[model samples]
Target: MTQEKYYFENPKSSIRSLTEDEIEAAIADYENGVKISEICQKYPKLKVSSFYKQLPYKLNQEKCEYCNNQIYTKVRKNGYGNDLAKLCIYCNHDYTKNCNCEQCFHNTNVALEEKRKELQIVWKNFYTEYYNLNYTLNDISIFDEIYLVLLIQSYKGTFENTLDFSYFKQLRFQVHASSHEYYSVINNLIDRKILIPNIYYFDSYDYIYSSEPSLPTINSTKINWIPNIIKTSGTLLSVSELDKILKERTYSVEDKKILWREVYWSEIKSYIDYQINI
Candidate 1:
């Protein structure tokens, strides 16, 4: 058995487990008079998988040496003599580790699954926005998605409109991660054209606003690619019109970079027209 603790802190149940002898006794009681629910309530540490190991009707089946759970085999041995019942999913060896944590139902595997589901909702909205703009995201891992969410939240909506490379290093990484992670994502963003490092830093003030040798008077918004312009219309668009329509939608350097766009020539034309009108 693996002796290392499976929990970060004290687990929900401290007892090791109900012994096989105790389980057999319980099964005997269940057959005589005791209810199955009462037996389960009495031995809360006994998992359903473990309980099934003691069922009398099941024949010729062996208990997993590690966890003592029933190994229900369908197909026989493979070419290498490996059977489907060779290993339990949780404990992958002959001996099982002791993990009576609150979850196995508050365990790491279940917690991560739940967290992944939560993140799906968040990423769904993010991807849905890009889908309108003819962009998409590839298969990203759960851990990366978690880190991305944390990174974006740290920015507090400042990067949503603008992909300012100057400040990517400033935001706090959630789990004490190194600055290299942010820098890596930044470089990728630049490659994706999500972060035009100094899109707003043009020296030609004459081209921006009239009668000022300085930058245009801007608000708290970050300037993003107009969202869903192609999905909304096939006609040519002006930059001024795009700005008006997509003023409310914004993209941070990170958000835009994560999106993978499938470019349409017509959409590109509209975008070029918008830029030309600007």
Candidate 2:
């Protein structure tokens, strides 16, 4: 016979562990509104998630008085893509059957209501930021107004380039003016070189607005369109030109020239102050 290795002899127990009846009594104490931490203090082996599982089962057992069969098990279903679960029961007939009890209905409704409240808070923040940025009016030039309106519309990714007549009508009414007045303001901006028109052939709008002023076709290969804008002397500027100037050093000769041509002296001082603070 081969020799066998032994570790240690098992000792016989004199003291007895808690029986199933004792466990049931502890569970009853938990069901009768005893604090979980208190129970944990008494029984150090109890876990939190496991303790929470008992409450729902105990509550369901009391609510489900119709069937003599113990609710052997309870399962939760996806609450229609919500942060909630649908209470279900396993009966003697089938494991797949859902509980259509009144208590289950009430729980589902309450959960859905709570979810709606959470969603409303999220939507409130979104709308507040959107309205602050786009709707609230501040001291703005006609050029800035038109640019902002177009930019917002573009961001929405809905309306076409063609002006929304309804929006124009609403704005006209709000300003206590006509479409002609709005056009006149825009025309002044063009004359003052505040709003530079796009030169692309495809962007031409003859029906609703005045024809874009004639501009030299950009020589993409030979000349840098941006730097050329800084060099040229003209009343009307282009968007591409402005973009280029903004990219260079703020106090550059080109920048000063552009500022001298476009912005007032006080405005220039304020701009300098703002840039310094930033």
Candidate 3:
């Protein structure tokens, strides 16, 4: 009778174990709109909390609703007072705003304005030098031709198809014996600061005309280029000259310098063409 009192051990375990196939099936059922509780019920061994833990990893398999981008499983805060929201890093959007969810627009606008100002300064300096070179070579002789070729090639980093030096020989046949002489002149010009080597290429024919050598004076000095134009024409020469020319037809030292470097070179060509026939 005592021997008949032995009991059988329980086969069911507290810890639930699911195979890879079973897990995939659970995920597929949840994706098909089945509730987590229902999934647990169907699995019998799967706990409710355990199903929620698997939910994130499983739901991340789907794509984002906004940009059709892949959804990321990691949750992040939307902003102040908002709960953690799901977002696609590729096309981030806060669903609450009802806008294309992205980072703050204010920051983006500020960044763009700063970049625009920087680009404007760069272009202004580049154009100023270009105009200076055009004025320096009033008649465009062999020296001017070679200088221009080197200048363009220097700044642009490489020679463009538009630059051709064959015309220099046709002009009065006074061309140098060889092009090497032109290179030597350019090298001397670089050393004298009349030309600045290309900032990009350390060792090459690339060079930019320098404005430093022709800086204008601040006082009402000689009629060096700019004041001459203002005196000849009753009208103001440029925007910088409008105030000075209208008030006294005289420019402060700084303003005169700026006018000479930035505007005089471009306007000088037209002024000279009108004054002289050659």
Cα lDDT of model 2 by residue, 176-206, tens digit: 2332233243323333333322222222222
Stretches of candidate 3 exceeding 4 Å from the true structure: 1-110, 118-135, 138-141, 147-278
Q: Candidate 3 lDDT, tens digit per residue, 1-278?
A: 11211111222321125655776676567556577778778788876664433432223455666566555442221123323345455566434454445553544556656654554455356536743431122232333334443433332222221222234334322233442332244333333333332222212111222234333111101111111122233431331342232434344687556655544554565577556756
User: In order, what lDDT does every prediction score?
Assistant: 0.38, 0.35, 0.39
Residue pairs in collision within model 1 = 103-106, 103-107, 159-252, 160-251, 160-252, 161-222, 161-223, 162-222
For model 1, the stretches where C-alpha displacement exceeds 4 angstroms are: 1-134, 138-148, 156-160, 163-165, 173-183, 194-278
lDDT of 1 at 123: 40
Give the CA lDDT, 0 to 100, for residue 184 in model 1: 49
RMSD of 3: 21.9
The TM-scores of all predictions, comma-separated, are 0.20, 0.23, 0.22
Winning model by TM-score: 2
> When superposed on Cα atoms, how far off is each prediction in RMSD?
21.4, 20.2, 21.9
Q: For residues 37-143, could you state the per-residue lDDT of candidate 1 as single tens digits?
A: 67777877644433433342212246655466543332222233333323333443322234443334235566656655554444444434533333222333222
Which candidate, 1 or 3, would have the higher TM-score against the true structure?
A: 3
